[model samples]
Target: MKKLFFVGILAALFVGTTNVSAMTEADLRKKFDETVTINGNKYAVSDGDKKLADDYLAKYEVSSDDCDYIAKKIDEAKAILTAEGQEDLTKLSESTKTKLKKLVSDVSANTSVKGTVTSGSVVILNSDGSTFAEVTSLVKQTGTERSNIAIIAGVAFVITLVGACLVVKQVKNSNN
Candidate 1:
């Protein structure tokens, strides 16, 4: 009888302590949007140029790594244009095309894209594992700052869990 009563009380206490407002898909999406926005302004290629590159690859034989390299080069070209006070890239001038051609040829002779360039779309997944993978990828792309944030978040979660357990134990002790 005592064991059953104790179990019942424990279940009740746990149920009462359950958080009603936990993280939702919307929250994750919001964060994704923010991250993508910030990264895009910082290092991403223009959407129009990205589309053109994608279309070009659709009709060409290209390795994944080569495609990534090409995309990176395209973004670099866009960065140069932005730096030169040329925001619009409606038409590629002969000089610009010549420069980009040289870049492409140079890149083709070397390695493919490897590091996280912080110049991609935001991806959110339905499953927890997939979401975690996306978060890991994002952290990698964002570099050390986000990695530190992830570590701190993990520590805070552990602390919160431990604090909750202690509170439950204290409540049970008080009841006794």
Candidate 2:
């Protein structure tokens, strides 16, 4: 009875906290309209762009080594968000891509895109475990910073598709 009561209480606490904390459309709109100040200049921040920073922030703590790097990336992110810069989204994407291409390798490189086939086929599954933060922090301290690449996720999904085909081949081989 005591155990059940404690479990119920814990469940209620978790549920109560998460339920009301979930943001609604109004809350998201308010967040979108928010401004963030950097280097004495205030810039409007989009909720989506902030989410990108937040994705990095999740893994980042305030560290002397990372403070400057993270801060710099945060600044770049602000530029991207501008909330709106030159009115050229394509230009923004290209610049970020150029800077990151040298520093960041393809994220899906280690993921198995190919498997061997004998009389039987082998199954290979490749998935990207790195979050955007890890990707941003990809070579940190050992620190190689990748300016966010807009097409990286799309590329990763395509790479994963090759592995997905391998899985199908394996399934067919096993059935035979």
Candidate 3:
């Protein structure tokens, strides 16, 4: 069953890439904490994710239709995450999963652009970077691949060290 599902996903991704090459660009930029109130609570957008969106879009000539399609896929990714209750990358509906794979393959096909597009806690890259939704689909697709995992891991370690050092500095300052 799992194999069948993965096969289906891989098919979707390839289909998306073929179709997405002609897409135009869209405005996906957003400020840190850009939000709308939901049930009297403010829901914020991640600044890093916006930067990812900007970087990817700038590198490619995405058509308006593809742009909208991607934007919609982002929402669907979130809904899948919510419905599956965290880190269950296999929970997307068949159609939604197909669309997501398409976006991944599309992004991956653009060899000129190499990096990740993250939003909130989502890793939006599939061809090179890490995205749970995309990984299962691409695992079987073979080619001389470029991976950003090491770079991302190193950067993450550095960021953690910097954060720790800053926290220590703050603690010392408070003591003094």
- lDDT of model number 1: 0.36
Q: For each candidate, what TM-score against the reference?
A: 0.25, 0.26, 0.31
Candidate 2: RMSD to truth: 21.4
Q: Candidates' lDDT values, in order? A: 0.36, 0.33, 0.41
Q: Report the lDDT tens digits of candidate 2 across residue range 87-160.
A: 43223355543432311122112211211111211111222432222112112355334434546866888999
| Candidate numbers sorted by TM-score from highest down | 3, 2, 1
Q: Write the per-residue lDDT of candidate 1 for residues 39-78, one digit (tens) a residue.
A: 1233233333233323322333335455456446545654
Worst 10 residues of 2 by lDDT: 1-10
Clashes of each: 0, 3, 6
**Top model number, TM-score:** 3
Expressed as tens digits, the lDDT of each residue in 14-102 for candidate 3 is 22222234433331222222343323433333333334444444444445454455445445544443453423334445565555555
Better of 1 and 2 by lDDT: 1
